[model samples]
Target chain A: MSPRDLAIKDLKTHDLTMREAARASSGARVDLLLIAEMVRPGSRVLDIGSGDGELLELLATTRGCDARGIELSREGVNAGVARGLAVIQGDADIDLADYPDNAFDYVILSQTIQATRRPKWVLEQMLRVGSRAIVSFPNFGFWRMRLDLLVNGKMPSTENLPYRWHDTPNIHFCTIRDFVDLVDEVGAGIERAVALDASGHPVRFNLPWAVWNLLGEQAVFLLSRKG
Target chain B: MSDSDTTSGEIRAFEPARGEADHPHSAVLRFGADMPLQLDAGGVLTPFQIAYQTYGTLNAARSNAILICHALSGDQHVANVHPVTGKPGWWETLVGPGKPIDTDRYFVIGTNVVGGCMGSTGPSSLNPATGAPYGLDLPILTIRDMVRAQAMLVDHLGIERLLAVVGGSMGGMQVLQWAASYPERVFAAFPIATAARHSAQNIAFHEVGRQAIMADPEWRAGRYLADASSPRRGLAVARMAAHITYMSDSSLHRKFGRRLQDREGRTFSFDADFQVESYLRYQGEAFVDRFDANSYLYMTRAMDYFDLAADYGGVLANAFKATKTRFCLVSFTSDWLFTTADSRNIVHALNAAGAPVSFAEIESDKGHDAFLLDEPEFFAITRGFIDAAARAVGVN
Candidate 1:
């Protein structure tokens, strides 16, 4: 097993609760836990493009949040529903408009914004439907990816983004600095931001956007609408 | 030979059939003069009977009860051997021991609608005042009327609040009606391949079937029982036409195509030259054996009269205003009869009402009838929603 699995096994052996074991085990995706941590307990949440409902399950089971999901694929929606989560088969770009304004306390898009056709519009919709929004995505400007592109003369393929250039669903990829600029353009206030390195460890940067863009492989942000 | 038999010798095709109205395989609930059912089409029905079949055990809290509503042609024998056809029940694919419905965990109840022929007070039953078949005399029933009678049955069973109400097609309409009329009484609803109201195109199809049945000389002006004749051919043709609408072009192409029925090549006379024609002939022939012609007219008319949004000041969301009932609406991608747009309309209304709802448009070429078949994704959602709802309500 991987080192993460061994640590989770050790946590389970030490009689941690299922939620703790789950949180400790890295069972839910790393970025999903980060999003879940940002949500207040017992808040209403909607997860767009919630593949298999891993984050919804985390929010509901651990935080007692009223979690719901929208998935684009029939297979993904059915899989989420089979796991006892309330999810609908719908497109993130189209179906998000159906939900009323301020319907949820927190609207989340984790590791999925890059795949969205209109990232700014989706971010605006998330803020419209929820009092707060949480978004996480792989940063395209990590040093290793830049190095690979410079030396190998090929499109960057790092640990966080392993997809081939042609078949990748990440059509609108952005660097950390680029996302921060887009967030500002959409009149959003970033209340909290975390930059994580390759090993799922937060870089703990109080530095500039350029430094975070070059160092962090992934980024998560908690935002609210600015008047 | 008896005088009645001799008089109607040529029309002996009926089953002699409406016999189930009295001697049915289900548990019958009879209403006396004290319990008159008020219908939406402007009158009341008295001394009626509701035939229903039950599976599993009602929990001590009665919170495990699930009421299953049958479609236009279905009856209460939802998960048993049909008494007339001697075949498996209509929804046997979804409801049985260890099935997705899981009889071991749910007290599932399937009831024949108020206008249905199978042991229910329908057009085929005897008129208590006249001692002849009610026929057209039975007050017109609506989807609301069907659900109203079902509410009575639920009350009779001592279930104040049902854990869930589920169905497909016309049955799904009734499920929506339940959500609207008795919102507090239902905890969850599973409506598959359904809509809030019957579409204009659907009404047109039903009209075609109605005309076919009415045009038959054997109909005797809807008093066929009094004339001792049944419109077998007309009813069969009606079923055949409606059956075509229930399937998609792709599925039809896959199942029957332009292939010959048997014999290598076609004899090409006015015979069953193609396999599809032969198959339709079989369907129509088998349908007339078990269904009542007059009941067909009543069921179709009820569907045509359904318009829930019109009743609520032209707003569909108003019908479900502040409803606590959890809803899961599903549609098939190829169901032209009740397309995915219909399901989305309901989803939008529920979203407007701020009700908890989930919707899915499953990919299948089997058309509207896909809900009745063994589709893995459909079954998984069904089982999961029920399981999760059970946990929410604290049902063991």
Candidate 2:
């Protein structure tokens, strides 16, 4: 069976137990757990670029949220739908605008921002449609990426950023500092932000922004419209 | 048939011919002179009967029953062998022992609509007062009436609530009507390739078909049964036009595309020189053999008059405000008749009412008939939606 089919089958067989394990596993991806933590129980959520709906199922079962998702690829949507997630095949850039204002309690764009054609507009629409928005993406200014560019003289690829530069879907690559600046420029308030290391754990709880930007391999931010 | 006969197993009734019977697959629900159906068009239909078929076995909780609403030209032979066509049921692809509907898990019911000719209390049925076919004298039906009749049947079956109500096209309208009319009874709803109200262009097409049927000389003012004649020609033309609407332009072009008929070249006459013409002609000819003319008119009229929002003071969300039913709307990308926008509109209303709803726009060039076709995306979405709803309703 394909990886997607296996993932769906795994979900169908395991249900809540597997999800609980994934949430509690220290080896689990920190971004997914952090996003799940930020969302309140019984809230309405829309997950953009909801790949195979792993997070969607987590939210619905663990958090008791009314979860819906919009996945870009047919395969991802099929996998999600087969696992009984309310995932529709849609483009995040074009379909996000169709949602009504304040339609969801939380709108999540997880590790998919850099792939979007219009990342800024997508964030703005997410804020407009949801009371709060959560976004997570791989940081391009990690120390290893800088060293690779400085020593190897080529674009960097890490465990999180697995694709080669030419074939990568990360169109608008952004560092932790760059995303923070962009969020400020867009007039949104950052409610919480976490910079994670390669092992999927926070780099430093009380570090300076520049220090965290240099060492953090990935970042997650909770944002809301500025008053 | 005994009362126990109607409750379990297959019970055939009213089978006069192999394919020409009123009710073929199961027992008929006969209403005496005391219990008359009060129609919206201000007429009383009495001494009537409703023909229905069932699949799977009802669970002890009686909570695993699903009501499958048939479209304009559909009948109660869902998930089984169709008596008239001598073929598998119309939805056999998605609804069977192991298919998406999973007849092995749920007790499925499909009833002939009130205005349908398939053994239901339609224009073709006999009127006790006149001792003849009701024909034009039959009260104009609506989607709500059909749903009400289904509710009566559900009551008779001792099912307090349905796990889900599912349908496509005109059948979808009944699903929506069930949600709106009896919010508590319908636990979940799947309305595919349908809109809250018929589009103006759709009404125009129905009007043209009605005019065709009415213009036939053999119609005899819908008294053709008494004269031992039928309006075959007019019904054929009507079906031909409606068939065109069911298919997409791209599909027709791909299937026919000015291809020659049987002969190599045109016969220099108005004959069916092109393959598309011949195909449509065959469709029309085949349709007239099974359908009744007056029933066609009534069914189309019922579809045209369906406006759920109008019944709820012009706000679609109001109709669903009290509804606890979970909804899933499906539409084809290339279906101009009931486009994705229509499903989106319904989704928005459901959202406004704080109802749980999902919408899927399956990519297909099969047009409105995509619901009836073998679209994998549609099947997956349906399976997912139904399974989730089943879990919610405690259907093991």
* Candidate that would win on lDDT: 1
In terms of TM-score, how similar is model 1 to the real structure? 0.92
Model 1 lDDT tens row, A92-172: 888888888998999999889999998989999999989899999999898888999999999988766788999999999
Residue ranges of candidate 1 with Cα displaced over 4 Å: A1-26, B1-15
- Residues forming the 10-long window of minimal summed lDDT in candidate 2 chain B: B9-18
- lDDT string for model 1 (B127-216, tens) is 989998898988888999999999988998899999999999999999999999999999999988988889899999999999999999
Evaluated against the true structure, the overall lDDT of model 2 is: 0.82
Put down candidate 2 lDDT per residue, B154-246, tens digits, no spaces.
Answer: 998999999999999999999999999999999889999999999899999999999998899988898876566788889899999999999
Clashing pairs in 2: none
